[model samples]
Target chain A: MIIAEQKPIQEIKAMIASYQKILVVGCGTCVTVCMAGGEKEVGIIATSLRMALRLDGKKPEITEDCIQRQCEWEFVDALKDRISKVDAILSSACGVGVQALAERFPDKPVYPALNTTFMGMPEKHGLWIETCRGCGSCELGRFGGICPIARCSKGLLNGPCGGSQDGKCEVSKEMDCGWQLIYGRLKTLNQLDQVEEILPPKDWSTDRDKGQRRILREDVYYEQTV
Target chain B: MAEFEPKLIAFCCINCPSSSVTVCESMGMSIPTNVEVVRVPCTGRVDILHLLKAIESGADGVYVAGCSDGNCQFTDGNVKANRRIERVKKLLDEIGVGGQRVEMYRMSAAMGPRFAEVAREMTERVRGLGPSPLRR
Candidate 1:
């Protein structure tokens, strides 16, 4: 899931300082699972903002609402009435949800209340670690299912990088060397010979190097015909 | 401000603090009139939102009274509540509200005097801090 964390309350307060009436929107999908921006979090943020604003001697009218998935046009459309009532929006969804709202309501101001960090899963209760870089490619088969692009400090392809010591990365003692994990897993599977096969350089164009990425699915595209 | 009577909210665990409250009342020990006692099944049920809402709604201070450590009926309800109290304290500090206003106290059902003591302590501390800034 797309993991994110709420920005500091002070930062969020500053972003909507000028607006007298603001709508706090939450997403129920990814951010909800991550406990960053869900219905419960929407209420918390809204209440906290009210207290903070009151402390500053500003009586702002704040509203809270959560949609199933803020990234979808249909879900965002449900907030049209609420959006019309507020001067601006404080979105607690990931970056994708914020952008979707911005594009949907170009005339209205929208601000993000979270810092979308990475594509990852929860390591444990209240802990999440990056797992995928979304390089627009999948090469997990070559690395024993461990993602070097996201876990390795340098994202080395043909690695171990002379900095792997005792299975730990040289950059940080807490981080495990990604190549070492691959080596151990391969060794357990009796497939250590695969490590000797040198691979070609990754195609950078598939990544963010080409700017904004999109998929044109002709089968899924719906055309309005009058 | 008229002697600054601090309004406090105490979320007490049903299995222990509830009985303690009764024992204290029956023994002619009176809690401060401004302190409101709310009974919950367990202190673990008290979310940070409830604490913040108490303050937002004009509570000068708020605290949770749960069963002493390992004595909780659910085994670790008091332990979980302790961690939540710490989290709410940090949040209060970040919001510039002063974390000292919120606290957690653990006592057994047999300790009626301890219950009254915690109430007086919290009320006095809040009184010293003055009314909550968010109070209208």
Candidate 2:
């Protein structure tokens, strides 16, 4: 899921001072899965804003709304009428949802309440780690399941660069050496022989830096509107 | 004018609102005619902001009424709402408003008279407490 973390309430209050009628929009997809921009978080942000406004001695009208997904137009359409009532919108979605809301509501300002962090899975109940960079290419087959692009301190595509000490990365004594983890995982799977192969220099063009990319399958598309 | 009535915003659950509203009406209280009823699908749906909005919008006091504990049709709605109420109360205290401006209560739909008693009780309590410092 797209990971996100909420900013402090004081910073958020400063952003919406100009608007009297504000909408606190929460995304129920990636942010919700990560427990960042979910319905519950939306309520917390809304309540915080109201209290801050009361402290300022100004009557700010804030409304709260959450949609299943904020990145898609079809889902955002549900909020069209409601969106018209607010002077501004504060999105609890990741970067995608914030941009989507901005595009959908061009007339009104859309501010982000959460900082989009990374693409990762829950490490445990309240902990999450960066796993993938959403790079166009996949190289996990070469290095166990861990993505060197995200886990390796230097995004090293080959074995450790002699910086590993006792299975710990030189970047931090606490961090496990990504290459060591890869070596162990491969050894356990009897795939250590695969590591001997030299990987060519990574082609950055195919990755996200080039621009936005889209994938379409004919099977998923309908000839006529279904 | 029928005298200056204090505006109250009651965030109540389906189960508790019915009884509370009935009780207030029987006692000729009728929520002080200034109270606005915002019923949620469940008290669990009531977030802390709803209470703050009530206070920010000139409400003298905010009350969250929910189904009595295990009596909630939706299981933990009332309990969760109560927890959130307490959390917000702490926040209110931090702001010098003193959490007394907010409260949570549990009741069944059939407990109409009990609702009125709570309304009178809360009304008197709020009356004694005076207007919210934020209220202009």
Candidate 3:
């Protein structure tokens, strides 16, 4: 899921400072799962903003709302009525959600309340770590189910780098070496032979190196009118 | 000039801290009128939002009273509460609200006198810091 963390209260305040009445919107999906930009978080950030703004002596009117999935057209479209009432929008969703709202409502100024961090999952309660880079390629079957491209300090495809020490990455002791994790997993699975085969350089075109990747499924589209 | 009486909110855990407050009341130990005691099933129930909301809604200071370390009925409820209290304190400091405005106290159900002591302590602390700038 797309992980995000709410921007500092001061940053958020500045984003909508010019607008008197603002609506704080939350996404009910990934950001909610990370406990950053969920419905409950919306209430918290909204209340904080109200108090923060009051301290500035700007008694701006602020309101809160959360959509089912901010990335979807239908869910964000439902906010049309609410959007009409507010001067601007402070979106507490991921970057994608923020863009979706901005694209949907070209007239209103939309600002992000969160810094969309990464494609990740919670390692434990209240702790989220990046797990995928969404590199637009899947070779997990060859690397024991972990993506070195996302987890390694250097997206090494062949094996661990010299920086790997005792299964920990040189970048940070707290971070486990991604290639080490893969090596361990393959050893346990008796598939260490997979590492002997050196993988060719990944096709840069398949990744974000190519501008704005998209998938147009002709099968999913409606038939042309007669 | 009038004396600044800080408006305070205390989220008390029912098992120990609340009982201690009840005992204090039964013994005619007067709690500071400035403090409002809010009973909760556990200190862990108190979230960052709850503490922030208290300050936003005119509380000059806020606190949580829970069981002593390793003594929560739910085993780790008070620990969880401490983490949230610390987080709120950091957030308050970041927001220029003064983290000293919020605190956490630990005591058992039998510590009746201690409950009143904590109430007085928090009241004085808030008084020292002056009323919250964000107080409504």
Candidate 4:
């Protein structure tokens, strides 16, 4: 899932300082599971901002709302009534959701309250670790389910670098060497031979010339389905 | 100007902190009138939002009184509550609300006098800081 963390309160404060009536929006899908932007988080941010603004002697009207999926139009449309009333929006969702709000509500100024960090899963409760870079490629099959591009510090495809020490990456002591994990997993699966064959370079092209990647499924369009 | 009377909120774990408050009162110890006690099953139940709400609702000071470290009935409830308090404190400080307004205390049921002492200490600290900026 897409992982993110709330931006510092001061930065967020500065972004919405000009707006008196503000709406804080949270997304429920990815950010919810990752504990960055969710319904509960929405309450926390709104209440904190409310108190913070009051501390500055600003009498601002703050509202809190969350949708099932901020990336989708239908869920975002549920906030139309509330959006119309607010002078600005403080989006606690990921960047995608923030852009969606910006595109949908062209009139109101929408600001992001979170830094969309990476695609990851919870390493443990309250601890999220980045797992994927979304490099527009998937080669987990060759590495025994661990993508060197994402897990390796240098994104080394062939094997572990000399910097790997005691199964940990030299980039950070906390990071596990991606190739080490791959080798261990393959050994356990009795497929260590997979590492001997060097893999080819990844196809990095995802239509970079177009500026943004997109997917359009003509078969899944509503008119055709209906 | 009249003397500033700080409004305080205490989240006491039902197991120990709550009992300590009760024991303290039974022993004729007086808790500050400005401090309100809220009983919860455990300090771990005290969330970041709970602490923030206390401040947003004009609490000059907020604290969670839980079981002493390593003595929690739930094993680690107090530990979790402590982390939450620290996070809230940092967040409050970042927003210029003064994190000193929030605190965490460790006490068992038999520590009746200690509960009152913590209350006085917290009340005095908040009083020193004056009324919360968000106070209506």
Worst 10 residues of 3 chain A by lDDT: A217-226
The number of the candidate with the highest TM-score is 3
Give me the displacement of residue A1 in model 1, in angstroms. 0.3
TM-score of chain B alone in model 1? 0.96
**Candidate 4 chain B, run of 10 with poorest lDDT:** B127-136
Identify the leading candidate in terms of DockQ: 4
Which of candidates 1 and 2 reaches a greater TM-score?
1
Candidate 4 per-residue lDDT, tens place, B69-98, comes to 798999999999999999999989988888
Q: What is the lDDT of residue B1 in candidate 1?
A: 34
Mark the regions of model 3 whose C-alpha exceeds 4 Å error after superposition: A223-226
Better of 2 and 3 by TM-score: 3
CA shift at B41, candidate 4, in angstroms? 1.7
Ordered list by lDDT, greatest first: 3, 1, 4, 2
lDDT of 2 by residue, B1-136 (tens): 3533456677888666665676657767545555567878888999776777677667888888899868888889888889889977876776556689789988877677777666667777777787777764
Docking class of 2: incorrect
Ranking by DockQ: 4, 1, 3, 2
Provide fnat values for all models in the order shown: 0.37, 0.27, 0.40, 0.87
Worst 10 residues of 2 chain A by lDDT: A217-226
lDDT of 4 at A78: 90
lDDT by residue (A7-115, candidate 3, tens digit) is: 9989988888888989999999999999999998998888878877888888888999999899999899899999999999999999999999999999999999999
By TM-score, how accurate is candidate 1?
A: 0.95
